[model samples]
Target: MIARLVARTFGLSIAVTVAALVVAYLYGGPAALFVCAILAILEISLSFDNAVMNATVLQRMNAFWQKMFLTVGVLIAVFGMRVLFPLVIVWAVAGLAPAAALDLALNPPAVETADQPSYQTIMVQAHPQIAALGGMFLLLIFLNYAFDEDRRVWGRFVEHWLARLGRVRHAAIIVALAVLLICAQIVDPAHRSSVLTSGVIGILLYLSIQGLTAMFDDDELPDTLDPAVPDPSSTRPAERDRPAHLPVGGKAAFMLFLYLEMLDASFSFDGVIGAFAITSDPILIALGLGFIGAMFVRSITVFLVRAGTLTEYRYLENGAHWAIGALAAVLLVSLKVEVNEVISGLVGVVFIVAAMISSIRANRADARAATQTAAGVSGP
Candidate 1:
């Protein structure tokens, strides 16, 4: 079963890892190889919630779009986000020309020279803006999900009140704006403008995507394929049916693809930066993140969709959204204070593992209830 689901992804991942590590080993010897290995593992673990969050969106897309995600999406994630995005950020933030930025990345200085600080130094300097941009986008997603009236999982008193607050028009936006302002207030004066601008842009981008999705909604557009529906022999009731409102494609498909890519960029904001702590070599970082880490994350997303894992684990999506919320908070807070990436990663893992356990118990309870009902009816 595992082999059938993960064959292609696994095969691709292995090939890439071997090739990348070989390059690393040749370039910088054992140290480089080891660093690459650690980076790949770190990225996969840190991005566990990212995989779950991605699956939620991908499952709503059709087969063709899904392939695009695995192909086009990977390219964008690997090159656009991991490679070029950082260079662009350094150029914009540090006021360097394109060639200069590439030089800074390629042949980083031994020290933070006065004239031109190292690429990693520039990246560290740019963190607040990066955090603000990603934080706002992700925070809106969490707030919208939490405030949704249909949200039935992880119900507590807090959720009840959140749902009540959600009834207000544009509650997510209101909350996000308020949080953004608060983040602006406390962040260093140096980063205030950049953070504010990035945060606002993030909000606008999110709004644009939602508007496009609504505008492009048409029966003529391609309807989303239920990834599980192709198997006629599958007995899982959850996989037997499609969502009541199927997602439409065309312009919306392209928009969703864009949204997914941007979502990945937001997630990678930390991973790319954090890789610097291990090694400052641009080549090694790319080998680990772009080639290996990114590949496996895409593969894991495909596996989750095909396996119907989300449908089976009822609360898994909730946990992932919660993780997104935590990440958003961490990102926003890091504008003022340095927050460890390990802590950020662990928060998501804890939520996901707990949710999985809850799902297992819920499934067992459901089974017992069904059996009891059948037994009671027969006895009568």
Candidate 2:
């Protein structure tokens, strides 16, 4: 099973690793290669939660969209978020032209020098705004999952109560807004406006994508169908048989693609900023962290879907969302206090591992009960 899962992404993974090594080698040497390897591992560790969340959504998409996610969607993640986004942030914040921003990224000055700020320094300084936007987006993702009234599966009592509260209209949005407001108060006064604005934009972005998708969603059933009216013969049998309505076609797929990219961007914010701690070279950072990391995430999503891992470990989705919530809180807190990346990664891993263990125990208990019932039916 492990081999089969690896086989699906083996070629792509190998290609990405080779590319990373080559890029690192060209940039520096053997030392650079080792750094690239370390960065790849860090990216993978930090993003396991992202893989689970991606699988939860990717499995709902059609085959074409799934392929698009692995292909076109990955390019956006690698280049758009991991590469261009940072440069753009530096450019905007530092008030430098695009060329100057790129130059600063490619050739960072000495870190110890007090005379001028390095690219890393500038990026670190911009973390508050980045945290605000990414934190709010991620918080909303968690809130939506927790407050989903239709969700029948839950792993905790709090989640069940949250779902019950979900009956209140827009409860998720209300909770997210309250959290954002609280987070804003904790941000530096100098960056307070920027943080709050970015957070509101994050909420708006989520709403816009979701609303647009709903508008284009062809499968949404009417609130009430007249019982007296017969079924429309024009509706295809296959369409009727579909157990769930998924976003399909050009417009809906585009909206879904946008949502996926936004989610990827939110997840990548910490990794992108954190990569500076390892290296200051933008090219090496993109090659090592962006390319390899994005590929592995995509591969994992595909593997989970193919292996039916989500179905097998039912609580895993709940765990991933909880980890997302924790990560969001960490990001928000980091605005006021420095947070260790190791702690962030470990929190997510702990939740996922716990959920997996619980699922395994449940499966075993079910099996044992079934065996006992069968034995009882077969009289001694």
Candidate 3:
């Protein structure tokens, strides 16, 4: 029953994803379709572990949150992150109106038409600041994943005192808002409200959603699940038998979704920048990469469900964890200096592939031990 359910879920996600791509194709030209295909593959390759990371939490979500994740999540991925995000950055840095920035993106100078102002230009304009923000974001993610201790970005004084007062979430929200207000004041005091409100709301919206989701997910390696285990499947069944102890609930699931999107945005920094290097047409970049990448992520989510890859490949999680760590490092570097998407993509791929190979080898070894055990028992 569980297997069938998983299969059906996987199939449905894939169908929807493909349908979205078809719609994009109808609206845009063939070149748009081609770019979308490439973007989908690239995102899939970069995010092999993201599904695993999500499944760990998403499984605990109620049907409602899960559905919201697929639907709303897609909207955010396609529109906010892929299509509109670059424009937002461009406007913020270039002091252009949204429409003006859109114009710049849509129509580059005739000689520069072949290389119009694109997501890349936006990133370059905001490179100094993005590199700083992205670097910090990535660093925190990495430390949380790779280190042993529980990592918290907020200071201990604030966490203990403010949280004890039953106002930590509130205070944090306020602080975030204040920070944006200050930023807007510095950038353009008179016009600060418009950009400031949007920026704070955007970040807060995603962060709150993700935090809610993480409350439910409790999956992690037991201290004793040693690499020496001869049978990988043995661990999986055992892991499944154990009840989830993490904080995942409806509220938690919402938070997790928010976090995942933020994580996705962090990843998007380079991709958004890199897309422009290929072509400066924001429309082409948005239609090409957004639809394709979103579809691929949806497809991979389905594939993970169908293959039961999350359960079967323990090391895949390890790889993803590592990739997230690498990405965090990349983010940190981005804050200080420009880092190419190609390099970022390669770094993630290497970590995941290495972990996958190790996982397969371990599985084979486990199979051999089981075979020998059976022969020995029969001889007796």
Q: Against the true structure, whose TM-score is highest?
A: 1
Q: Per-residue lDDT for 50 in model 1? A: 92
lDDT (C-alpha) at residue 79 in model 2: 92
Whole-model lDDT values for every prediction: 0.83, 0.82, 0.59
Model 1: ten consecutive residues of lowest lDDT: 230-239
TM-score of each: 0.92, 0.89, 0.67
- Model 1 lDDT vs. the true structure? 0.83
Best by lDDT: 1
Model 2 per-residue lDDT tens digits across residues 1-380: 78967786667877978978897898789998888888888888989999999888776567888889889999999999878888888888888776887898777765646556778888998998999999999998888888775553445478768878888999989998898888878877999899999999999998999889778665443344323322122143432333544436567777877888888888888888888888877877888778888888888888888888987886798889989998998899998999988888889999999889877877787789889999999968
* Candidate 2: stretches off by over 4 Å: 110-116, 218-243, 378-380
Error of 2 at 39 (Å): 1.2
Measured with C-alpha atoms, the lDDT of residue 134 in candidate 3 is 48
Ranking by lDDT: 1, 2, 3
Residue 162, candidate 2: C-alpha displacement in angstroms: 1.8
Model 1 per-residue lDDT tens digits across residues 135-169: 99999888988887655536456666887788999
Query: If both were scored by lDDT, which would come out higher, candidate 1 or candidate 2?
Result: 1
For model 3, residues 121-207, the per-residue Cα lDDT tens digits are 555656545543544444444433443222111222432343344334344345445544445555434434544444545554545
